[model samples]
Target chain A: MSTADRKARDKENLKALILQGAKKLFLEKGIEQTTIRNIADEIDYSVGTVYVYFKDKNAILHDIHTIGFQELGGSFTELFTIEDPMDRLRKMGIFYMKFAIENSEMYDLMFNVKAPMEFIEHSEKEEWNEGVGTFNALKNTVAQCMEKGHFKGHSLEPLSFMIWGVVHGMCCLEIRQRTKGVKFSKPETILMDGYHEFLKIIEKL
Target chain B: MSTADRKARDKENLKALILQGAKKLFLEKGIEQTTIRNIADEIDYSVGTVYVYFKDKNAILHDIHTIGFQELGGSFTELFTIEDPMDRLRKMGIFYMKFAIENSEMYDLMFNVKAPMEFIEHSEKEEWNEGVGTFNALKNTVAQCMEKGHFKGHSLEPLSFMIWGVVHGMCCLEIRQRTKGVKFSKPETILMDGYHEFLKIIEKL
Candidate 1:
């Protein structure tokens, strides 16, 4: 490769390294407790090097959050091959739930954490394209289900939002430790069990 | 009143005053930003006096969360009088959504915030009686619905939890500003509109 091309690639690789370190610290110590210095130490880079890639913690949080959406999208890539919208919708929820459960810290950062949204507020482009894109995936699937004559009496947007709420709610409760405190009969399996109940209801719908 | 009785009443009133002030600061400046000193200043009490009432911020958070449950129960009182379990369950969700949206801060403390749960972990009892009581209310209503031949093939606990998740997910998303970030067609009414979709699905079930 040419020297200029190699330099550009090196810069991109360094930026990715900083983001990876930031994500690790966010998971281990929590987003609120993790700082730029922590990220710098995690990657064996100077604090100045970390700052060269991102303006501040919020900028790092925003980038990590964006990466989370990309990872989630990558996970959903296989579902696109399914022909039936109804079948795809059911599996979409399962994928969403599994992703949330397995990568909870990242999921929390993507959906629940305020820093990324706060970052968006201060940035010139205020739209949350990551969230909008994810929501639209669900909305589009629901729209297809409607075309196939499911969701008979439901409005599209509200119905899609309701479905999103169901899965997000289950995942949020589990991740936040609310499920364990409630002492469900099947504490370990309540997230999936509750989700199955939703699947049953939606199948009939 | 006798001197002893007057002293006891005054103490209770002062404790309530402190909690009210803390909640106000929690709402205005956020829970993390509001210190014990802020609470004391808000109520015109000394920091030591506030300490005399509660050990730390967690203690205050735990107590406020208990009060939030009580307020929720108070809001639920009228629903209990409905003869039909299905009707009562429908209205119960409505009441829950209303309480969550109207008192977003308190609702976050009751369900989402980690401080109260952390306090419970360190306390002697370690049982979340408040969460248990609230869940039992929903469980009993769902039990009634099952007895009436509604929810014919669903397990009681998971189904109840799913119902809880539905409302909670919508409220959490809205409270955490996820709803607005997604750019919903009707951001203002999405919570209720999403809830209405849930009501429709359960009605069929």
Candidate 2:
């Protein structure tokens, strides 16, 4: 490779390394407690070097949040191959919940935390492309289900939003530890159990 | 009132005053940013006096979290008067969503934040009474609905939780500004619009 191309690739690799370190510290301590210095320490880099790639903590958070969406989108890629929209929608909810449960800290950063949104506010971007893209995937699936004569009396956006809300809410409650306080009879499996109830309802719809 | 009774009432009044001030500061600034000093300053009390009333910020947060439950419970009172279980359940969801949207910050503390739950862990209470009581109200309503020939094949707890997840998810997304990021067709009405979709589905079930 040419020297210029190698230099560009090196810059990108270092940026990814910094993000990987930040994400580790974020999950270990917490997003609020983790700092740029802590991230630098994790990756054995100077704080100055870390700042060269990212403007500030929010910038890092925004990029990590983008990475989180990319990961979610990657998991969702297989759902596109499912021919039946109804079956795809069901599996999508399951996959979405699995992702949220498995990578809760990242999921929290993507959906719940304000820093990423604040980053968008300060940056040139006018919209939350990550969030928009994910929501669109769900919306399109619901639209296809409607075209197949399911969701007989439902509007596209609100109905899609409701479906998203059901799964997201369960995941949020679980991730935020609200489920522990609620004392479910089967606490360990309540997330999937509650989801199954939703599946039953939507299958008929 | 007698001298002893008067002294007790005054003490309770001062404690309530402190909580009120702290809540105001929490709403205006934020829970993470607000300190005991800030709470004392808001109420014109010394920091030591604030500490005398509450051991720490977590205690204050727990108290405020209880108060949020009280407010939510107050809104739910009228729903019990409705004879039809289905009607009551429908109205209950509306009341829950209204409380969530109208008192977004308090709702966040009640459902999403960790401080109040942490307080519960460190305290004598082994369970979240506020959460249990509120959930029971929904559970009872759902039970009645089942007895009245609705929700024929669904289990009570998971179904109740699923319903809770739907509304809570919508409110969470809206409060966290996820709805804005997703570019809903009618951002202003999406919460209720999404809720109405759930309402319609449940009505048939």
Candidate 3:
């Protein structure tokens, strides 16, 4: 390989390593506590070298967001492989909730807090889109499910938005440590039941 | 009334007024910008009076939370007069959204950020039982509906939590201002569609 190609690969690897270290620190210590110096230290690199890749602290956070979204888009990719359109739609919702429950901070990055608009506004850079935004994937599934004669009562976009609303809302409450008062044995079970509720309505449609 | 009773009532009213002013200002300028001194200035009271009632900035936040929980709980009092369980559940969810929509700041206070968990752990506070906490009234309605042979399968708490998940998930995404890339014509319509899906499982149950 050419020297330039090797250097590019090396830079990419370092970026990923930095992101990995940053995500860990941010989740454990919170965004305020995770410093560039700390991330550089974690990766056994100098702070100046870290600055070479990222312009500033927010830039680091933006990269962390990009890394998170790329992985998240991959997570929702499971919906594309399933054949039964109806089942795919159901699984998509389940996967969405499952993703939120598993990688909470990442989920927060994707949908909970504001994403600096640059990331959401198309200036997000190529690495951020993965296979298009996960929202599009979710929308396509909903549209396909609608075409197959499931969920006829609502328009595609709104329907998908509502589905996300319920899922995110429940998970947000659970994550916020407020669910203790709600008296649920498990939050997932509720999600499943709610999913079934939606399934029932769609079948009727 | 007696002079002592009048003084006590005036003190309570002034404290409430200060709290309301603080909440309004905090949302306008953020938690950091809204200060005790500023709050007192808004109400034309001395900073000393503000400190007499509140130990610190966090105390004012605590009182605002107390008031917010009461307002959130009170939203249901008008609905309980309706006897139809299914409609009540539907309205409860809709009202949940409306509450979040109308009282944006209070909604932020209730679930978006962490509050001082002073009154929630102990049951002595008013609105602690029945329908005070956001989960209580919703769960109570859900339990009643389940008992009436309306919806089946899942337990009420999890179902309630799931319902909340989707509702808040949608709201959170929108309210947090990160839906720039997300394409949805009618955001609420997309979100509430989860309810129909929810009812499907309920019917089978």
Candidate 4:
């Protein structure tokens, strides 16, 4: 590899290390309590070095959210590679739940909490790609299903929101310990119920 | 007023005062930053007097949530007086949006954040009033539509969840300030889209 490529790789690795340490601290102490100094202490980096990498605590949170989205994106891509659109979507629903269950902290940051961090943008218009790539991924999959004629033509955005609202609402309650007295089916059951309902609606359209 | 009634009235009045003061502080400084002493100071009450009214800050939050729900329940009850099923439901959807818009802090406490305060149990497992009152309100209206032969024979709970899930998800996103670029159809359009689509499903059933 060229010298420039090697340097870029090294810088990416450092950023990843900082993110890992910061994420652990954020989950343990919460958004308000965790500080740059604490993250530096945990990672054995100097405070100045940490500052060189990130602007402030909120920057760290922004990076953490982006990284979470990246993971969730990968998970969706991995799970939805089935040749049939119907099969792909069914698997996508399971992947969505599995991703939530496995990455509770990051998942909360991505969807549950009011993420404190804001992004620097060039325009007044919405950059659907900037902070919303994760949700858009789900939307894209649903749109593809419709395009492939696996489902009838429904507004993919609202349908995506509906399927997400149910599953994400349940997941949010579970992660936050709020689903008291709720008659929960198995995780798979809950996930499939959303899938079945989506298919039912799709059939209507 | 009788002496006993006057005493009861004053007691209720004082509880409201403490909650108003505490809620103002909670919103201004957030939950963690707002202490009992700060609430007492905000209301110009002695710390001892504040304690007499509320055991702790959490107790105040619990009262806030209870009061919010009580008002919400009353709002829904008033909406029930309407005769047309679709019109009534459409109004109910508007009322839901109205409540969220008018009472931002209360909305946050009711749906997103759990109060740390103790809620007195008014409903046993066999008779959970909140869930029952809520779904029954929807069911009774839905029953009207069904009786009119608007919907054939579908279960109310699932239908209610569908409607609730859509409205709740929209409000949840709105309050979180996450719908930056997406302009909603007049609440009527979005609600009709989901509500009528739901009615269509019900009709098919």
Candidate 5:
């Protein structure tokens, strides 16, 4: 590659490295406790180098938030190969819940935390492309299911959203400790058990 | 009333007043922005006085969390008057959404915020009684529906939780700006529209 092209590539690689470190620290210690200095230390870089790449912690958080969506997309890779929309939708939720449970902190940052949204609000474009892409994928699957004569009397967008709510809510409650407050007969398996109930309902419809 | 009885009544009244002021500040500013000092100032009391009634901000948050449950219960008072378990269960979700949208900040504090949960952890009881009560109400309604031959093949607890997840997830998404991130075709009425879709699905069952 030319010198200028190599320089641009190096900058991109370093930015990815910084985000990787930030995401790890965020998962380990949570977003509130993790700092730019901590991120620099984790990546074995100077604090000045960290600031040189990103404006502030919010910038790091926003970048990591996008990375989370990418990871979620990675999980969905196997989902698209399935020919049946209903089956794909079901597996999609299973994958979504698995992602949330496995990466609880990142899921919280993506769905619940305010800093990433605030960063988007302050940015020039002010569009949540990552979120839109994720939602669209689900909406498309639901639309296909509708075409197959499943979900009669349902609007595509709202039905897709409701299904999202079911899985997301289960994960949110468990991650936020709200489930602990309620005495479930089986607290440990409530998320999966709840999901199965939803699966049963959708199969009939 | 006796002097001791009068003193008890006065203490209860002052505690309610403090919570009212604190909730106002919380709704107006936000949980992070509202402080004990802010609560005191809003109620025309001293910070020390605020502390005298509640140990810290978390304690106040716990009390307010209970009050949120009480307000939610008030909304459900009309629910039990309906005879059909399935109908009651449907309206319960509607009322729950109405409560969430109308009291968005309080809903966030009850479900998403960590402070009240932290306070419960530090307390002797170590239970989230308020959350328990709210979940029980929903569970009871679902159990009644099951008794009437609805959800014939589903387990009671998990189905109840999934149903709860459906409504709670929608509210959480709306409250946390996730709905805004996804460009829903009908952003303004997605919650209700999504819920109507759920209602359609369950009516068939």
Candidate 6:
């Protein structure tokens, strides 16, 4: 490879290394508690080198947020194999729930935290590509389901948004500790149980 | 009234006054932005007196969290006039959404913020009374719906929790600006439209 191409690849690799370190710290101490210095320390790099790759903490958070979505998408690879749209949608929710429960801190950064979003707002892009991309996957699945004569009489976008809300809301409530306040009979499995309840209702539709 | 009764009444009134001032400040600024000193200044009470009424910021937060629920409950009073359980449940979701949209900050405190839950965690109660009470209201309405031959074959608690997740998740996304990120077609009415989609699904059930 040319020198310029090799340098470009090395730069990308280092950027990934920095983000991996940042995510590790964030998962350990939460996004609020983790700092750029901590990330540098975790990655065994100088703070100045970290700054060379990211403008600030928000930049790192935004990148990590993107990675989180990518991970969530990666978890969905098995869903596409399910032929029936309805069945695919069901498995998708289960996979979505599993991703959220397992990677809760990453999930919170993607959905709940304000930093990554604030970074988007201040930056030039002015659109949440990660969110839109993930949302489209669900929207597409739901649209397919609609074509199969399920979810009748429902508008596509809103119906997609509603499905997103059902799963996301459960995860948000669970991660934010709102579910604990309510004291469900099965606190541990309530999320899956709640999704099952939703599944039964949607199956009728 | 006896002198002792008058003294107790005055104490209650002052406590209410403090909460009123705190709520106004919270609405004007935000919970994090509004401090104990700001609250005292707003109410023209000394910081020590504020302490006399509330043990700390969490105590004040816990009390305001209760008031937020009380206000939410007050909005639900109209639901009782509806005779049909399914219809009431629908209206309840609508009213719940309305409350979340209109009282976004207060709703965040009651549902999403950690202070109130942390207060519950550190305190002796060990149970979330306000959350349990509010959830019980929803659970009761859902149970009535099942008794009336609606929602066949669904467990009561999980069903109620899922319903809660649907509404809460919508509000959580909207308030947290996730809806803005997704760029919904009707950004302004996505929450209600989403609920309508949910309403369509449940109507079949």
- State TM-scores per candidate: 0.93, 0.95, 0.77, 0.73, 0.93, 0.91
Residues B55-85 of candidate 2 have per-residue lDDT tens digits of 8888999999999999999999888889999
Q: What is the lDDT of residue A157 in candidate 3?
A: 64
The weakest ten consecutive residues by lDDT in model 3 chain A span A123-132
**lDDT (tens digit, per residue) of candidate 6 on A87-107:** 999999999999998999999
Name the candidate that leads on DockQ. Answer: 2
lDDT per residue as tens, model 5, A4-92: 99999999999999998988888888888887889899989999999999987888888898999999999999999999999999999
Q: How would the candidate models be sorted by lDDT, starting from the highest? A: 2, 5, 1, 6, 3, 4
lDDT of 4 at B104: 70
Q: Which stretches of model 2 miss by more than 4 angstroms?
A: A1-10, B1-10
What value does DockQ give for candidate 5? 0.81
True contacts kept of each: 0.69, 0.78, 0.60, 0.05, 0.82, 0.78
Write down the TM-score for model 4.
0.73
Assign candidate 2 its CAPRI class. Answer: high
Q: Which pairs clash (backbone N, Cα, C closer than 3 Å) in model 2?
A: none
Off by over 4 Å in 4: A1-15, A26-41, A45-52, A116-131, A148-159, A176-178, A181-195, B1-12, B24-38, B46-52, B82-91, B116-136, B139-159, B181-205
Residue-level lDDT tens digits of model 1 in B38-87 = 99999888999999989888999999999999999999999989999999
| Candidate RMSDs in order | 2.4, 2.1, 4.7, 5.3, 2.3, 2.7
Model 3 per-residue lDDT tens digits across residues B17-133: 988889889778866567778999888999999888776675677677667778877887889998987778778777777777677676766676654443454335433232235
Where does model 3 exceed 4 Å of error?
A: A1-18, A40-56, A118-132, A185-205, B1-18, B32-59, B117-132, B147-149, B152-154, B186-205
lDDT of 4 by residue, B1-205 (tens): 6999999999989878889888788778766577888888888888899878876655677677667777788888878678788678767767876787678777667666644322433223333244345646766776677677653334444444445555665566556545442333343345335334333433443
- Pairs of residues at least 3 apart in sequence or in different chains that clash in candidate 5: none
The candidate 4 chain A region of ten consecutive residues with least summed lDDT is A178-187
Please give me the total number of clashing residue pairs in predicted model 3.
23
First chain TM-score for all predictions: 0.93, 0.94, 0.79, 0.73, 0.94, 0.94
Clash pairs (backbone) in predicted model 4: none
Compare the candidates by lDDT and give the number of the best one.
2
RMSD of 6: 2.7
